[model samples]
Target: MRCEICGKKLVEEPLKIKVDGSIMFTCKECSKFGKIQREAPKPQRPGVSRSSRVTKRIQRPREPTEEVIENYRDIVRQAREKKEWSREELAEKIYEKASVIGRIESGKMVPDLKLAKKIEKLLNVVLIEKTDNDIRDEMGQSKLKGSTIGDIARIKRN
Candidate 1:
């Protein structure tokens, strides 16, 4: 290729172009003279990237426990602080009374299963069911004869 303008070697730029609705290759200098429009590279279809094949590990659900409860409270408190929410505002999100949330945080009550689950969901943390007793006696149906109703009632009432 030679430069049409200066007769210099028009290094092999091999410009594919369109001229008068036709396509061909020419030197850059000639391209400028002809006002030839260069063909734009075809847009490539995006491939399935290797990253797409990489699978993320599924996180196992954590067992709920006392530690989970404390951690959950801490997390909720932190989020509430970051969001600039009063305890009342946070309570609104969970449809709970702020005082109840306060009681939970202060460890004044062990949340029952349902309340614990609700708290866990609202706080985005696990806060219950970590320890499980498997022994049959734990179910309170032991073969051994248990104490009398009055004794049991007295014990329970206390």
Candidate 2:
């Protein structure tokens, strides 16, 4: 080990000292600049093993997540038409560009949660739905193969 302040190699045992309210391992010469501190033993649970802790974490329930509906583009378009609002008008109400509205309506782009919520409120349409985490877990368990990186990336992008 090396001294924190001087960066000198420590041939002997390093001292634990408190300098400016921070604990540091310092050489004997540098330790004189700070108050010596007593090293405390780390506390560990008596019966817990690393594998048991991992399994406990894995068994924890996942929270339900929200996702956009498959027919969101059609729903948004029909709702906006029913309200007799132009694309530009709807975009202005949602603080988005007309091009973005056009792309979403044309099914070229998928709106994120925040944008979908804004459009849903303005047009009074249901575009997002909550998916049960337990259902997803069951599906995942039934699949024989693991998800590839591309599949994971696609999930993340959405």
Q: Which number leads on lDDT?
A: 2
Task: List model 2 lDDT by residue over 18-97, tens digit each.
Answer: 99978799999999999997664232554546555666556554655677878778777877887888999999999999
Prediction-by-prediction clash tally: 1, 0
Candidate models: Cα lDDT each: 0.52, 0.75
Top candidate (TM-score)? 2
Q: Considering summed lDDT, which 10 consecutive residues are worst modelled in model 1?
A: 55-64
Mark the regions of model 2 whose C-alpha exceeds 4 Å error after superposition: 1-61, 133-158
Please list the residue runs of candidate 1 whose C-alpha ends up more than 4 Å from where it truly belongs after superposition.
Answer: 1-72, 133-158
Pairs with steric clashes in candidate 2: none
